[model samples]
Target: MTDFYDRAAAREAEILSDALAAQQRRARNGLGAVSALACEDCGASIPEARRQAIHGVQRCVGCQTVQERLAR
Candidate 1:
């Protein structure tokens, strides 16, 4: 009985952890119009599919990737 309760508690913790992570990701993604994709540096045309695939995207994939790399 005690083992079962411990397992349930662990599962609840896991679920809550996952929910918190998902919420954090959603918050980071932001909300914005799905307008034409543009480069952050030069206003270049970003592909339509790319814009559709990513949420709240502001920069081109190239620029975005570069920024990510630099961030790391």
Candidate 2:
């Protein structure tokens, strides 16, 4: 019973450690980065709200819709 508890604690610690590392990496990736001002496909300006909401958005809604359709 003690061994099982120990193993569970160890696993929990490892999972928490991995979660922290992933969060740190994601924060690093986002640091000093801004979303695109214009859509790559249509050369239209992206809205400020959308740009702030998305990390590295490169397309407007219309162009993204078209691209997604093409992808499918």
Model 2 lDDT, residue 54, Cα: 68
- State the displacement of the C-alpha of residue 58, model 1, in Å, after optimal TM-score superposition: 0.9
lDDT of 2 by residue, 1-72 (tens): 579889999999999999999999987787567788999998999999988876778899999999999999
Q: Model 2, 42: alpha-carbon shift in Å?
A: 1.0
**Per-prediction CA RMSD (Å):** 4.6, 5.0
lDDT, model 1: 0.79
All candidates: TM-score: 0.54, 0.53
51 in model 2: Cα distance from truth in Å? Answer: 0.5
- Writing each residue's lDDT as its tens digit, candidate 1 over 1-72 gives 479889999999999999999998786666554545677666998888877777667788778888899999
